[model samples]
Target: MTFTFTVLIYMGEMWKGGPDTVGTLHKLTIKAEPGSVVTCRSAVTIWCEGTMNAEICVLHKEESQKTWGTQTPEMPENKAKFSIPSVTQEHGGQYHCYCYSSAGWSERSDTLEIVVTGIYYKKPHLTALPSPVISPGGNITLKCISWVGYDKLILTKEDQKFLSSMNSQYIHSIRQYQAYFFIASMTQDHIGTFQCYGYYNDTPQLWSVPSDHLKIYISGLSKKPSLLTHQGHILDPGKSLTLQCCSDINYDRFLLYKVGEDNLTEHGNQQTKTGFSLSNFTLDSVSSSTGGQYRCYGAYNLSSEWSASSDPLDILIAGQLPFSPSLSMKPNSTVHSGDNVTLLCQSTNKVDTFILSKEGAAQQPQQLKSKFQVWDFQAEFSMSAVTTALSGTYRCYGSWDSSLYLLTQASDPVELTVSGEVTLHDYKTLHSTAPHLENQDHTLENLIRMGMAVMILIVIGILIFEGWWSQRQDKKSTSHRVPEHGK
Candidate 1:
C-alpha cells in the first residue's frame, strides 16, 4: 500500500524536486579558460560546473545586436565543456551560459568576449601618418590600407577591440581602398601595441590575420634627431647611399623627410633601439631625383612626440662621366630606303658606355659599350634597312651607367633625311614646284621619267585592247546574221 504523487510542471523561477533531481542552476558556474581571445578556425572550450541533470544553453551577444539568445553547445552536461570547432568573425562576441532543470531556470553567467584572427586572407597594412610619433598634445593618424576590397577594417590595441568611429576624433578616407583614423591630443594612455584586420562584406564574421604589431611609446625630446649620410654631401650617381637618423635620447622609431616636400611624403620604418634609436633610409641607387635636403626626427614610439627637425643635410649627385660622345652617320647627308646606316659615336675621353637617343622617337634609347680606340673610345649604332620612320635628330652620350640622369652631357644632335620611293602625287607636286631643278638631281629625274614611261605604255595598251574588242564584236555579228544566203 504505497502511494505516489505527481507534480504539475510550469516554467517558473522555482521548482519542487525529489531524490532523483540534481543540483539547481544557481549552484552552477560557467567560465572560459585561458582568456577570451580565440583564433579563427581553432577549437575553444567553455566549461560549466555544478549544473548536473540540467538542460544547458549558451547565449551569444553580437556586436550589432543588443539581445541575447540560446545557442547550441557541443557538449551539454554537468561540468559541460562546449567546443567551437571553427571560430570565425561571427564567433567573436560576448558569450554566457544558462541552465534549466526541475528547480527552474538559472541566471546567466558572466559574459566572455572572444576575438578571432587569422592569416587566411589579405590583411590590411597599417601605417602611421605624419610620422608615427605624435607630440604630447598633438594629433596623429593611423592609416589602414586594404587593396583587395574589404568592407570593414578594424584596429585593435593590446588585443582589445577599438572602434574607429568611437575612438577617433576624425576619420579621413584617403582613397577608395584606404582609411585614416585620426586621434587628436594624445596622452600616455593612448600609447599601446596596435594591429589591424580586414573583413569582406560576404564574410563579415571572418577577419584577416593581425598585421605586424606596432608598439608606440612616449618620449620627451627637446632636440631633433641628427641626419647623416654614408657618402658625404656629394653622392656619385648610380651608387648606393644610406641616410641615418640618430638621436641622443633612447627612441623606438625614426622619421626622415625631404625638407621642402609635403609632410605626408615623409618616410619612416621600424628601427632597432640601442642606447639611441638608429633608422637608416637607403637609396639603393641614387640619381638626380633622389638628391635633396633631408632632415630627421626621433621619438619613443607612435604616441611619443616627435623631436625637433635635425640640421638639414644637402645631398648632391655628381657624375664622373667623360665628355659627351660625338655622333656621325655613315651617310651624313642622305639615307636611302633599304640602306644600312651606321651611326658612330666617338668620345675624346675614355668612356664606358654610349647611348644613342633619337628625338621625337617613342622607342627606347639604343645602348652599347664603348670600344677602346688608339686615343679615344667609340661605339657604332647600326640602323639596317632604314626607312623614313628612322629619319630624325639623334644625339649620344657617354656614361658608365644607363640612367639618363647620371650620364654625361648630350652630344650635338645630327639631322638625317631618308629618301624612299616617291609617289606620283609627290612627283607632280615636285615638278609643279620646281620643274627646271629636277634635271639637276638625277634621282628625281629618273623617277619622273619612269613614271612618264609607265603612263605612255598604259595608254598604248588601252588603244590596242579597244581595237581588238571592236574586231571581235564585228565577227560575232557576222556569225549571227541568220545565214546571209537564206536572208
Candidate 2:
C-alpha cells in the first residue's frame, strides 16, 4: 500500500499530475503584421491517475469572436495535443485552455498572445503641386505619395522603378512639403502613369493614383515654306492661287495668322492674302515675293505652350507680267475707212491678261487667259464696223500674274483715211464692217434709144414681106377664074 511508480518529467510545458496537483499551462504567443496568417501547433502532456480531456487554448479573436483550435483527450494517460488554424491579427488576444479532471475541472492555463506582423501593400496617390499643362513637349513635377506611416517606399514610372528612392522616400506626406518627383523636360518619353508603394507590416501599402499630365507646346515659322493652295493648287507668281498657313495650334488664331508672304523677294506679309486672305489674306494677286516663306503661330489651348508650324510651304511666282501691250490692224494691206478691221495686242512681257478699250474707257481691265485664240495666246479688239471716229489710234493693254503686273504700252496711232468707193448712200454703212453688197446702176434712157433703132429696121423688113404675099394672092385668083371659063 505504500509503493508508487515515478515517471521522469520533461521540462517546458510538461506537467505531472496527482490527486492534489492543479492543471498548469505553457502559453505560446505569436506576433506578426496585420492580416498576416500564422499556424501554431500546440502539444500538452498530463500525468494523471485516470484519462482526462484537455484543450489547446481557445484562440480568441482580438476583433472577432472565434476559436483558433479544437479540444483533445489525454488518451495516452499523459499526452494531449491541439492545433491552431490560420490566424490573423484580428485573432490576436489572450488564449488559454482547461483540463476536465475527475477532481473537478483544472484551472485555465497561462495566456497565449499572438502578434502578427507582415508588410502590406496599400493604394498610393499622386498629385501635381501646380496645375499642369499638356503639350507635345513640356516640363512636369509630381508628388508621389503613400500612407503616412509607411516611411520606406518605392516609386516607379511605366515599369522602371525609381532605383535611387527604392530604399528611402523623399516625399513623406502631402500635407508637409518635403520631397517631390520631377522629369527634366518631359516628352513623349515621359508620357505614362507613375506608381508608388512602401514597406508596411501586414497593411502593405499600394501605389498612389497617377499624377496629372503635363503638356508641351512649341512654335515655328517657314524658312522654306510649303505652299498650301485653297481654291486651286500650288501656284507660282502670275498664276492666280490662294495660300494658307497651317499649324498644330488652337483654332483661336487660325483666322488671326491666316496668310503671309515670304521674305525672299517681297516684303513679308504684304501680299493680297496677307491683306485680303478672308482669314486675313487673299491671293487674288500673287507675286514672286508671295512665293518664298510663310508662317502660322499661336498659343496652345489654355496653356502657355505653343504649337509649331504644321508644315512648311514653298511657292514659286510666275515670271514678270506681260510687257508693253500694243494694238495694230490685222491683214497687212491698207485698211480702207469702210473696211472692217481687228486690233491685235502684242506683249513684250509674259501675257496673263489682256485689256481692250477705246481711248477714254475707265472700265476694269479684262482678264485674257483664253478670251481670244490669237497666235500664241492673245485676243483682238476688233472694229466690227468701220467708222472714221472708230479709226482713232488703236491700242491694247495686256498683263500676267493675277496681280496684273506691268502692261505693254499702247501701239502707235494708225492714221486712217476715209474714201467714197461708190456712193450707194442708202445701202452704205459708213462705220460698219459687215460684208458689203453692191447695186450696179446703168442709164436706162440711153439703152432704150439704142433698142428703138433696131426695132425700125425690123419694121421695114415686115413691110416688104407683106407686099410679096399680096401679089401672089392676086395671081392665084386670076388662075382660078380662067379654069371656071374652060368649064
Candidate 3:
C-alpha cells in the first residue's frame, strides 16, 4: 500500500551587537573564526594573544563607532578567548584586544570586522569529527555544515565563551559551507554541550539558525564508581527513588551527574567504614523529566580530582498507570481506500489525553482527549474516507496532566492492511480480531521504505534544478555586461 506523511516542526525562539577602548595601541593580534561572517543563533569566538603579566580583554566596536565595549573573562595569561553563544544581528561589529598590566593598559590591536549572514535563514549542521566521547589529554574536532553560502562559522561550549579557530579545509564543496574546530588535549573542563553557527560574509551582524547541539563526554579516570538505584531503574509516579554512589577506594565526597544536565549534584560528609564511602540522593516523587541516564563519581577532599564515572543507568518512569493501554481497529480486517476507519485507544486507568501514532511517520503523534467516559478509559479516532496514507501500524499512549508532555508505556500495535481489491480477509471473516502480518509486520517497514524513496527523489531534483539555475544566472550576467571601449 502507498502511504505519505506530513512533517512536524518543533517550536522555539532567538535575537543580535559591537565595541570601544582608550590607551596606546599594543602590538596584539585578534582573530575571528569562519572568515568573519556568521549567522544568528550560532556561536562565534574572538581570540587574542597575551603576555604573562598582562590581563587580556576583548573589545568590540560597532560600525562607524569609535568607542569599544569589553567582553570577558579578563584573565592574566598568555592568551584569551571571548565567545558569543548564538550571535545575533546586533553582534556584527569590529573587534580588537588590549592587555592591562602593572605598567598600564596597552594599545588596541588590529580590528577584525565580523559580518552577519543568513540572519533570517535556517541553522547550519554540527557534528563531531570522530566521536562524541573524548579521553583525557586526547584531541577532538567539531565540524559545522551549511547549505547556504556563509563565510564564518562559530563554535561554543555550553553557554560559556571558548576559543574558536578555523581549519584550512573550510568550505570543501560549493554545494555546502563547512568549517572545522580542532580541540587538542581534552580535559574535564571541556565536557559540555556545544553548537555551531554560520554568518554571511557581507552582513556580519545577521546570523543563521543554530546547528544541532553536540555534547562532549570526558572519560579516563583512576577507578570507576558504582551507581545504585533505590529499587529498579523504572518506577511509577508518586514513588520515591534513591540514587546512591559508592566507591571501593577511599573517598570523602561523591557526585551524581544526570546526562544532558549542566550541573552535577554533590554529596559530602557521609559516614564511611573500611575505606569505603557512600552517598545517596533521593527523589521524593518521580516525574517524567526524572527519567534519563545517570552516573556517579567519587572525589577526595584533599585533591580537587574526581574518580572515573560509574556505568550509566537508564531510569524510566511509567507515569501513574498500573498497566499499558490497549489499541485496536474497528473493522479488524483488510481495509482499502475510500473506507471509514476508527481506532480505539483503551486503558483501565483514567487519563487526560490519548495519543495515536503511526509508526515510521515523520510527524508527532496525534493527540485526542477521552470523548466518552467509561470504566475502561477509551478514546476513538475516526478517519473518514480513508486514503492509502491511512494504512499503517499504529500504537496508542495514555497520559495525564501531571505528566504534561510525557506519555505512559505504549499499547500493543494494531495493523491496518490495505489492498485495492477485496478478498477473503473481509470484516465477516476477520471481525473481532486484530489485523496481523505473516510472521512480520510490513506496514511500518513499507512506509519507511517509501519515505526514503521520496526523499531521495527530492534531493536528486534539487541538485538538477541548482545546476540549471547556476548556468542560467551565468548566461544572464554575460548578456547584461557592457563592453569596455578599449577592449
Judging by lDDT against the true structure, name the best candidate. 3
Candidate 3 least-lDDT 10 residues: 6-15
lDDT of 3: 0.66
Q: Model 2: which ten-residue window has the lowest total lDDT?
A: 3-12
What's the candidate order when arranged by decreasing lDDT?
A: 3, 1, 2
User: What is candidate 1's CA lDDT for residue 70?
Assistant: 34
lDDT of 2 by residue, 1-487 (tens): 1111111121112232321243433223332322222222222221112224432222223333333443444455433444334434343344444444334345545444442222243444555433233345445565555545455454455434232243335443444322366656555545444554444433332222222322222332322222354533223345666555433222333321223311111112322433321123455577555544344444323433333443433333323343455566666325555566766666544566665545432222333463544445566655544545444433455555654433444445554443444333313453132343332222333455677887987898799889989999999999889977987
lDDT against the true structure, each candidate: 0.64, 0.41, 0.66
lDDT of 1 by residue, 51-89 (tens): 545654434353433323333334444665676677666
Displacement of the residue 456 alpha carbon in candidate 1, Å:
99
Clashing pairs in 1: 89-205, 90-205, 118-209
lDDT by residue (312-358, candidate 3, tens digit) is 87665654455688898878646775577889998877778887878
- State residue 51's C-alpha deviation in candidate 1, in Å: 10
Error of 1 at 83 (Å): 5.5
* Model 1 ranges off by over 4 Å: 1-38, 42-94, 99-105, 110-115, 165-175, 200-203, 210-219, 234-309, 312-487
